[model samples]
Target: MPRDTPYLQVADEIRARVLAGEWAVGDKLPSRARFAEEYGVGQSVAQRAMERLIIEGILEGRAGSGTYVRKARERRRMIRSRIHREGGGSPFRSALKDQGSAGTWECNSRARIPATEDIAARLAIEPGDFCVMTHYEFLADGQPAQLATSWEPMAITGGTDVLLPEMGPRGKIGVVARMRSIGVEISTAIEMPRPARATREQANFLGISVGDLVTQLERIYFDSEGRPVETADIIVPDIRWEIAYEIEVDDSRF
Candidate 1:
């Protein structure tokens, strides 16, 4: 039988200790010298073992602070549905309310920005077309929870009271209500979700480590004529929220 490498052996022992509740979450780990002495290995070996656990998310290293066991991640539930749109309330706020947390959001809107190819494709408009772009940062209980960048074609909303998503009479109401006010009756919305690693920008906004797990939802709203009215890319951190879909069953069809 082959023997395990020194670092692997030490790592396994430490993991076992953690699982056995030798140290509670957020407990600072022993110094490298102490671990080396306890494991009968070189200090380098002990360091390697700790580094491996850090990457695995069992531990975290704080600058200017000692290494500590990472706290268990809190998972909040987020439900996506047409009901939320029809309700005319912020979906993030609604989800947080369901979790007993107060949700608030800050938004900034920029108009006359040229749409990128991807945004153009999603909005079904030509590249370089003018669009009103809005960036939103949503917080739950004073903690960053989600980020969203939404775009609407100027051809659809320009010279209207709803040109800016967060201004005017229908401002901050919601996409469905705002579009309806402009004589565009939204009939359908499509969402495509994909798992991805957090970028540095996203990590900064969500107060998480870079490369953390995130879900990117590409959402598009369409009118009765199948014209794309608005599109948004919403970012949800996996450590903070669990994405759920609420689909209605069609008993009539059955």
Candidate 2:
């Protein structure tokens, strides 16, 4: 509409530079005037590109200074809604495996009150169901990376250790991996990304400020027969994690 026909293309050029390590994080980007001149384009085009990148959390703009590349952090390379798409495995485990070395988790389950509407729906057992809730605080390199809570219907996993009141999984094994040993193949998963404010407990668990930006991922796991099995909600510090998607463009016709 504004003759900035390919604004996303222009932004991709800058994003490639950032991702390639040519321009490190926190480095000041070229001024708008300079970029416009370099690309032989109007200032509006360059401005649009910068604005889009800022909105995508790739860059930051300061009032007195200039646009700066955001400090690169441990980025998430995978987020699959379906378990079999990304190598046919548990999406959450795949996501964590790619970001960094998997750290030990303290896993435990308890009979918890269904406090939120979302939880009630995910468990699919009614509003006040005695839910079997699993808690895990995952770490990477001995530092906290994320905290996750999973809820399941007590009717399905009622008498199992899924509702044990222990401190954690004493053996420190991933729940998904544990499920597989019991011949329950996790066949479906759904992930939702949301911007959330950190709670006091989440802040302490994540080692971040109470007001820091956080991206929360809610994943629902289902069995091969399409029955709901588990629902996991993961909290990741915004500054510490990123999600990337790569699409191939074929120009064979051209």
Candidate 3:
């Protein structure tokens, strides 16, 4: 076993007390100074212990409000697969279907936004080139569940029926269908997932604490001609979600 540090030891005791019902849901926890006094450790050690519990979803810190025990909710499962259902819908919708939960979302879009250096690289466009940007806040059972920002090159959808992702006559249809309408057959989507700490704004949007862990996916879609069509950054809170993947196996190996 790794050497137990002061913070972990302190955290273990606090977690035990919480599990033993020393504090009920919504109960305000002792201040860091009080915890240090009781644990006979430095205040920093006590703070670290509380932070550990916060990250574990046991405790939450609110500005101008004391830390309190958080209510427990089942972490929703979000599954990614090689196939999207025949028509259109987001992966969040697919995940909600598995949980028997209703999913809805709010989307706001802007056209002719300059592609940033990062987005430009992902979309094979030069920085400062124009793109249509869409921001999405997906909800499960009416609570915020995920956040996504997508960028599509205007050079591809300019003056087309699919100019705005969720607005035109055939809008709200997914990227594949929208792109297909413009004669771009989506052939591949690549996603790279990495662990991240939530920012203040992100924490506020997802109802999580700043510094709480999350999964960030850098995703891009390419057409049959191997040209990039769209790129997006997807954010999912780790405490509220369990991310999984369904891989399709080739039958020829047998």
Candidate 4:
């Protein structure tokens, strides 16, 4: 195994102290100068270790205030499932409703933008094909909770009011209902999620530090004909939320 760096070793020691209850939650920690002297490392190394802990949600740095052991916050569960909704609505909103919280989103749409290679692969379109793209900032109880960037081929929704996801007669409806309205039935939605590090922009939006852990969830909707209709990258912050999948098991076979 590769040897750990000095700063990481220092961080491990600090984390061990914290875990051993030497520093309780919300307890202010010593200054970096003190830590540097105590650990026999450079002050910069101590700073980096503290920053790493901050990014890991173990410590919190307040502006002009000393770093402190982070207070534990309750992480809410974000459920993804084949929820059967009778009418049209975003599944995200439905999910928040289930939790007794009001979920709202701010969205901006761009039409006729060329699909990037990644998006094209998800949509089964050639790169540079025109598509409609929308970026969503989802809020739960007025706090930014999730983010998504959705793409749809213009060939599928061109010239329709629904071209913009959050506009027209049936706006804010989910891909399944929206596609059904346009004569295309969305048959399946497949999602793949992996751990990711937050970018500067995502960190700012989600009120987390850069390099904080997040979940990059890529979901694509397929029509009954097996043609891709829409694709989106759903960003969920790991510090504040946990992902859950609801599986409805049928016992008739048993």
Question: Which parts of model 2 are misplaced by more than 4 Å?
Answer: 1-100, 112-116, 161-173, 180-183, 245-254
RMSD of 4: 3.9
Expressed as tens digits, the lDDT of each residue in 136-222 for candidate 1 is 998888988899999999999999999999888788778888888889999999999999988999988987656768999999999
For residue 47, model 3's alpha carbon misses the true position, in angstroms, by 16
Which of the two, 2 or 3, has more lDDT?
Answer: 3
Best prediction by TM-score: 4
Q: Which parts of model 4 have CA positions greater than 4 angstroms off?
A: 1-19, 23-71
- Model 4 per-residue lDDT at 67: 98
Tens digit of lDDT per residue, candidate 2, span 127-216? Answer: 777776778887766777788887777666555553442333522344454455556676656677898988889887876655667888
Rank order (by TM-score, best first)? 4, 3, 1, 2
Candidate with better TM-score, 2 vs 3: 3
TM-score for each predicted model, relative to the true structure: 0.76, 0.56, 0.76, 0.77
- Tens-digit lDDT track of model 4 for 1-254: 23268877888899889989999998999999999999999999999889878866789999999899997557899999886767528899888898999999999999989999999999999999999999999999999999999999999999776788888887888778777788888888899999999999999899776677899999999998899999999999998999999877789966
Per-candidate clash tally? 0, 1, 0, 0
Q: What clash pairs does model 2 have?
A: 107-169
Q: After superposition, how far is residue 44 of candidate 2 from its true place, in Å?
A: 44
The clash tally of candidate 3 reads: 0
Query: Worst lDDT window (10 residues) for model 2?
Result: 165-174
After the best TM-score superposition of candidate 3, give how far the Cα of residue 210 lies from its true spot, in angstroms: 1.1
Full-model lDDT for every candidate? 0.86, 0.68, 0.87, 0.89
